[model samples]
Target: MDGGERYQEFDPPKALRPWVRKVWTYACPSPSRTIQRIAPDGCPELILDLGDPYEEADADGVFHLQPPALFAGQMTRPIAIRPVGPVELVALRFHPDGARDWLGRSLRTATDQRLNMTDRLRDLSPPAGDPEAQARQMIDWMAGQRRDDWSIDPLVRTEVEAIHADQPSPPRDASARRALQRRFLDRVGIAPRTLRSVIRFRRVFDHAMAEEAEGWLSAGLDAGYFDQPQLAREFRRFLGCTATEWAREQVELARAIASQSYKPGGPEPG
Candidate 1:
């Protein structure tokens, strides 16, 4: 990774805060071709590539060039990405419920998929100026796209809040649980349990990175994992590698981007 690479996140406008989490930018003035593994963070994003496009690996491990603009849905697993050249892009990270409202459809159709947005987000042009300006422009566009009727489901909001707070979900009978699962599938593209697992893994990862815990064992335990073995299992499940191996990878750019999700008041990692 280039040492000069830059990444920053900006708060969205008040009107759009319910749906848009934040506007972020990444730029590398000097290019150094390096692949980065991105872990799933349970949020969807709209990316506007202002410079060279990236190459993303599919499940088969074939790297395909991405479009200049695209919508990335809820990711269930890690993905590998490499910049083809100098990287410059602005992205909108959306809340799970927000994405459902913005897309006007069930998120299940978008889960684990990346769709070209050039056609769907018609007439949207890459914003000019610096990162802050670009972020502001993106926020403006998102504000314009809002629908008066768009609102988050109360149950989904409550459940998401409980997860983030590390509190148990309100007790529900089997039938109610099934109903909530269906709603989660539509609005978040994953079940409540799955979201909890991902969020827990993310917390462990973040704590490890910040050295907030003494070691992986402590990190996992603090994040509520039952034991070291369970922690290792989650590491492999979310990152396709042991925590030690992932640390050895030393993909600085990817690490920096991931760290942004943990910023104060930032929505659950995306």
Candidate 2:
């Protein structure tokens, strides 16, 4: 079922801009609602459920209620979430290596899992009216904890940037490439090659969804995929379903965040 949802996002403070993409909040009054498919898009998020805790289902069919506050790592595959009641949630979507700065830990543990972070945010107040103000409050809290010694590695940043660029070829030197992979795995919680594929796949999906494509072939070529079959293969590999099947799910939150431009914010909650 489609939930009439309200989403709002804020530009992070200058000090945290390099690591933070945007902080956003989503609210929907429909209770017992399920979002069946969340396609992987390479972004990592710290989420806080201000209204109701949701249940998450993994690939194996195992279901568990997610924490009210948690850090969700890079999901290379589809995951499902169902809220037990009407929802009000806030989240911070981090840059590729941004979690390292905020979590003070390796992202490897967080990948494909909702690692509980509720304890860390217990003292902070939830955003009451203004989503932007709350986002800044969260940013300030994270910035206050920044360590002088911590920063995203220069090499890692360069490699991630290359993955997002038009051409994503890795280093020519085998040894150099291996070293880059190690650093990427350590900091980003996934192998360099895997990250590259996810990034590439997401570009196509985003393009396809944003523009009203006539069919997958047009989207595939536009996204730089080798062929329509290649795009289909990647879609099944990452999302465990055909692109057409996924389209039927109508994942509102995912689509809202993925839009090229944010829809205007809704009226503040009472």
Candidate 3:
């Protein structure tokens, strides 16, 4: 067996770049039960479990063993993952609008939910082999379905970019905004306002983490929040904890786990 942990990211083939982010893999040997907390990010994910199935704890503390292959929608709250044994995961992260285009289905069906993709994966000819092989097969499947002029709606794409790049302002006109919200829901799975909230919360969290000395107010302002109180409210709403509490816990387990995989000849995680 390979010693220590292994985690790496690979760029998708040029043809798949528009809809897909990078392909990444992470694996670590069996260890005491460990939980990794992932905060909401705007991106959705398609994941294949290459090892033992991991248990997922939702916001309400209910746990379920994840399916072998599943698609995760845009996360709105923190989700905790507890690995049963060894951990091995190969993931294909899609751009906010990318999965909608490739799936050719309303992303709304899977928003904020995890759906089993085992049957969909099994339908492909030449069964998936390993992590890398499965990713390639998935890419090929998407490639086969691509059309000559495949593209996300220009308006949706623009809005998605705007949400991520700067403070997402509500449309000036309420009626027109409602219409766009409906369209965004159809094309993007989640409501545009909700997506904006998730992105804004992520920005604040990341800023606070990166600049601990700047104080939460500064971090909040930098991330477009109105003030420190607003930032704290968002922290509790999305993360189920206050900024100070979460930072004190330093449950940045995902990054720490990934770092373990990067260590050369380092001991396997436990």
Candidate 4:
């Protein structure tokens, strides 16, 4: 969907453009626990308050934790919630670029280090500058691809198709290819090694409702997992919840939103 009022879901443009942002309704009736989940890109994430009171810092001094060091990419946090109060800010997913060739970098990483988004935006790039223009400049200087800004470019879809095929990388050149790959991964902030895994996991949503209805263990295998244990481990590591738990919460949230989402001749969700 275009950046107008039509946008209702996640969409990111190519490297040379501004990434699309979508925000759904608030999760008012949902639980209040600060559910911490990670995105496929390995970016750090946290569930927003969604109209409820949420504290970033917990009692243990764990300040609303950020993503892992190995992770650095655009982040899509909480799923859209409907049938609740109208939310001021909709959901968000990042099209990260602060890591320089790395898919991302650590917010806590010190300067004299690689590029960081917060630092670049605040310290380096001026606040008055156009963000999209700045992002484009950054990608160009770094010799990276453009953002997949839907209409003009379909790189995101192309990558999605390739990832869905579960294809491995082809043979490399005689040079230090492995080193190059590592360097690229570090620059991208996302190790290429984890791409398929993340893509496959994200694809779970393609049939989440149906498969999860049967059970996550079975769903995981059907979705390419070897066993329930394997799926469980990854789910916990990525989603911060067991398969059963995530499913239950999803079902609840979806159910709560179903009615509003299905009004006859209602606007479609992008």
The prediction achieving the highest lDDT against the true structure is 1
Residue-level lDDT of model 2, residues 1-270, one tens digit each, is 245567887777777766777788877777546565666666688888887778888667877898899998987777777777777777887777777867777888788888888898898777755667677777787778767776768788776777667466654698888887778877788886777778777766654453334565675677678777888888788777776666655455655665632221211111
lDDT of 3: 0.67
Q: In candidate 1, which residue ranges exceed 4 Å CA deviation?
A: 1-3, 127-129, 208-214, 262-270
RMSD of each: 2.8, 5.3, 6.9, 10.5
Q: Which regions in candidate 4 have their CA more than 4 angstroms from the true location?
A: 1-7, 10-54, 57-87, 90-161, 173-176, 205-215, 250-270
Please say which candidate is ahead in lDDT: 1 or 4: 1
Candidate 3 runs further than 4 Å off: 1-3, 58-60, 123-138, 145-150, 167-175, 207-217, 244-253, 256-270
Query: Lowest-lDDT window of 10 residues in candidate 4?
Result: 260-269
| RMSD to native, candidate 4 | 10.5
Q: Give each model's clash number.
A: 0, 0, 0, 25
Q: Clashes in candidate 2: how many?
A: 0
- Order the numbered candidates by TM-score, best leading: 1, 2, 3, 4
Candidate 4 local distance difference test against the native: 0.36
Query: TM-score of every model?
Result: 0.91, 0.87, 0.79, 0.47
Q: Provide the overall lDDT of each model, using Cα atoms, as 2-decimal numbers.
A: 0.78, 0.71, 0.67, 0.36
lDDT of 1 at 211: 35
Residue 80 miss distance in model 1 (angstroms): 0.7
